[model samples]
Target: MAGRFTGKRALVTGGGRGIGRAIVERLAAEDAAVVVADVDLAHARSAAEALRDKGFTVEARTLDVGDPASFASFDERLDVLVANAGIQTFAPASELTVADWDRVLDVNARGTLLTLQLAARCLREGGAAVTVASIQALLPNALSANYAASKAAVLSLTKSFAAELAPRGIRVNAVAPGRIDTALSDFGSEQVGRITGQDAAEALQRRLSTNPLGRIGRPDEVAAAVAFLASDDASYITGECVNVCGGDVMA
Candidate 1:
């Protein structure tokens, strides 16, 4: 567990599972004392327990990313922050509801805004921040209108934070994952099946086929990228995004 982050402290929103959990594991493995912050306190505690058993420095905390007040209670100085909490829904544009749009934007956009803003304040000099975006933000896809818009907003906000924090020596970047293997992928299968009138397996096949690698990406793969961007290895990087979609952006 001795790595670049041996003495660093990190916070990861939605760190209880999926890509967020992967990021937390990666940081902790690199010796960062990580706070697993999730709306589900149980999940957070579970993640912390697993990592703690492995002798990594980890802690559990409850954080509702959609609530601005949630960030206020977090006053710990940090070296890294991964704003990875988000939700997704699938519906045809014509069928998309206002409530759905608001919920999506509120969590994916406003939540990110608050989380990263806190990071900009809490991160020490030379600290780094990473945001979890989606390939849908850059690609024109069906059944994800609200998700795409919210992630696109994340892209813009990332740049804004990067610019504003540069003078203070803090870096801000984003990762846009495509067809990652996570709980969210199950939702993809169901939604794609509904849209294409295909069986679950067939829909999943189509989704995989969209990647030039002809497979789904892994959470650890995205976590590796985040680790790099949030370390001194990428000290010159900021306001940038690395796509972890197995070349799905090309497909």
Candidate 2:
């Protein structure tokens, strides 16, 4: 289990916090030299410094996944890529503006495309890519039209990339997370408050009741799945999305 990625180089977008940070830590734990790429340089630096303190080979960089210029400067060769940078906005369909829709798609869908394209250029043969999608992609939720649509597009891209990259000895996969207790999930509580007229805590409680596990998932849980897909252990898997949704998405 240790040193599964000894001497490997990995890049994780949005690695400053939450699920992305968790993925970075997991990869570093396995001995990969990890790049904590995020839009916020400070967060990325903080995460990298903390990991470095723990004796992990980690670095930080500012990367805007939606911008080609940012990706162009990413010159380091890579063995693993985790396309985890994304944003979520919640609003009723009628209340959603064009800007809201565009922003969500730009970051979640277009960003995934750009990240995968860069990985194609940098990843060595037999490398792997894992995308962070959402359970909402498969099980749509109220007031999350834009977020859900963008994630669904990511799922599609995962399959497409997997097929095209197979010839290059690269494997592409996705992890669809359930309700995870992160800042992103905290936003869900606000969304629930807006829709149901309840406080944030109550909204979260009501939401948690719907899951079969009767609780939200952890960021590290999703990271574990991504690490597996990125490792040689999942060599036979590609063009598939593994659900980490606590039985919320059975399909």
Candidate 3:
């Protein structure tokens, strides 16, 4: 594993925390020169610093995934790109505001579009791209209208990019995680509890129940899937979405 990415240069958006940070750690651990990008420059710098301290080749940068200009500023060169930057909000369909929908889509959907566009141009032949979608992309809940739709768009984009980039030997794939143990997931769980009149504990269990494993997923678990997809081991894999949700949304 250490030499799998020995000379590779990888870029991960939203690599500041949660699942994104896990991805950064995984890639760096495998000996890649990883760049951690986030809108929150401080968090990005902190994550990169910690990894650097671990003797991994890591750097930090600022990125607003929703901004085309931000994407334009990134140098068009890299071996791997993980489109993991996204925001989630919870609200019933009836109460969903245009602002909320736009914000979510702008980051989750439009951002991914921009990310893939960057990858298409930046990634050399044999490069790989992995997007962080969500299980909600396939299974929508009462409060996931906006968030789910955004992730769904990501899945579609993953396939489209895969198809278009195949001739160049670039692979594109996605991971749909369910009830992952991250701050964003916790926020969604709490919001669900408030909407369903369940207490925090009950709501958490409710979320867990959807997964056959009866447990929340770990960031590292999702990261592992992403790493595999982005590695040469999956050279023949493209236009595919891997659900890392412990049997949730089996389709």
Candidate 4:
């Protein structure tokens, strides 16, 4: 059977690892030519090469999601754009340095905007964009205030873009994931442990227990959601944040 994304061209940011990598792989599996764009050039190239070795059409590029110039330099027409690049910081709102907050916002919120803007400029009519938000955007976590705030902004941005882009036959959506076990989460846990004197495992356990699924989500699971949103199967879906959070939150 032909996959939903067959014949498409997808650009995925942060494609070096975790959910981003999973999305890149899935898109290729569905027969879409993919660009694995990431800040880690080595990881990006390795991912692209591995997919190529597996007979999937894929390429790799270096992109700093926070930098507009980095994104613009690619200048390739795309059918789908997945703004999955992001970072996290752990500290009480009062304890976090301004630099830490800025870093998170730059990578998460600003990066998302740049991805959407660039995609709008280069994608053909009927193209789609997917922004990766987080469950923390809806469920408050004091230690992750910066991350949560940025993700909240992503949801709003998705809606805003959808309203403006709908006239052009473009759809914009977002995915808000819960406790997914990825390198980003691992790094987040480590920072949490250092800041709160708790073991990383303990912190993760506490966080994961909040999910109704009783287990953290996998990157592939989140990728499936993103792919769905980017496909014609979701043609009518726009300006929505599909929560892949294992029922951790509802509204």
Candidate 5:
């Protein structure tokens, strides 16, 4: 059987843990040679080792998404790109320090641009790219202004790249995930609890209920969507942001 990505090569940022790791695993299982990039080189190597032990072709490398130099280095050995590296802090806009806001924007938005630029330079004419955004792109909250702004920029960036790369036969798209079980979300939920004095689980449950599906989504669910976007299955798709938000965003 010819796997969907049998001959593809993929570069996934933040591939050491959480949703990013799942995306890397899913792509490798579909027969793509994966490059797992993370800020934590140890975790990146461990994840790559685990995949390789399973007989997958994978390599680990250091990637600081907020740094363009990192992308320049990694682009030397890649094709497709998945910009899944991100961070968040919970606070009202008034309380969001300049440093925190800068960190989020630099990683989520600027980092995305750096990755896309590398993909445009390195990927073959028909190659694909996927940016991992968030439902926060559409559904803004008072506690996550910086995160939401960055995600909204991600969606815009995806469209801009799609337009710019369409002429070159390279496709660009994004997956906007809702609340999935991830360590990053766990940290954000804790911050939310501290700010609101509400139980983290209760806050999460209430948020999950807002989804028409009435539950939190899984990392694998988001990974599946990313795999599809990065595969030939979505060859004709570009300038689009797919919402895997469990019907939370109808548009």
Candidate 6:
């Protein structure tokens, strides 16, 4: 039997590692021709090569989602787009620098917009775009004001794009992951340690304690939600933000 994405072509930004890599792997496992797009060419090439070794149809491409010129070189007619490239910085409101704010928003918000715009231009009718947002958009951490605000924008953008693209037979949705075990989360954990004078592992543990599941989530778990939204399984689902936060954001 053929896989769900046997004939489909998918691209995932930041697909070199972490949640983005998991999404690429999952889609490839379903037989999609996957493009691992990342600013870090080394990671992208390594990921693509590993998947190819496993007999998956995968390739690597360099993408700086914040740059429109980068999209010009991406000429594929895509069936699925996973906008997962993002950066986070933790600072109190009083201490946050303008450069930090710009960097976070540039990658997390403007980058997402660029990805969606390119996807809209190249995606065939009935295509899908899934953006990786954050539970902080809803929970609102004081230390992550910039990150939260950028992701909130992403959530809003998803809805607006879903409405605008519905007539064109394209679906747009978002996945808000919480406390996932990835390098990004490790960075956040280290920041928490600096703020709280705790070890990184202890800081991470304390953060995970707040989750109803009593543990941090895995990248693959979030990828599963993205896969559902991208596949025919969620054909009727659009303009929604699915929270993969281990029940952290119940609303």
Q: For each candidate, give its TM-score against the true structure.
A: 0.97, 0.97, 0.97, 0.96, 0.96, 0.97
- State the RMSD for candidate 3: 1.0
Q: Please report how far candidate 5 places residue 227 from its true position, in Å.
A: 0.8
Model 4 clashes, total count: 0
lDDT digits (tens) for residues 19-101 of candidate 3: 99999999999988999999999999999999999899999999999999997678758999999999988888999999999
The per-model lDDT (C-alpha) reads 0.92, 0.93, 0.92, 0.90, 0.89, 0.92
lDDT: worst 10-residue window of model 1? 202-211
Candidate 6 local distance difference test against the native? 0.92
The candidate with the higher lDDT, 3 or 4, is 3
Model 4 lDDT-worst window of ten: 1-10
Which of 1 and 5 is ahead in lDDT? 1
Model 6, C-alpha of 107: deviation from truth (Å): 0.6
Candidate 4 backbone collisions, by pair: none
RMSD of 5: 1.3
Tens-digit lDDT track of model 5 for 106-148: 9999999998888888888888999999889887679989999
Q: Which prediction has the highest lDDT against the true structure? A: 2
Query: Local error of candidate 3 at 149, Å?
Result: 0.5
Model 2: per-residue Cα lDDT over 193-249, one tens digit each: 878688999777876788788888999999999999999999999999999988887
Compare candidates 5 and 6 on lDDT and give the better one: 6
Tens digits of per-residue lDDT, candidate 6, 29-141, equal 99999999999999999999999999999999999998888888887799999999999998887788999999999999999999989888988999999999998899757
User: What lDDT is obtained when candidate 4 is compared to the true structure?
Assistant: 0.90
Tens-place lDDT per residue, model 4, 131-179, is: 9999889877888899999999889889999998999999999999988
Task: Identify the runs in model 1 with alpha carbons over 4 angstroms from their true place.
Answer: none
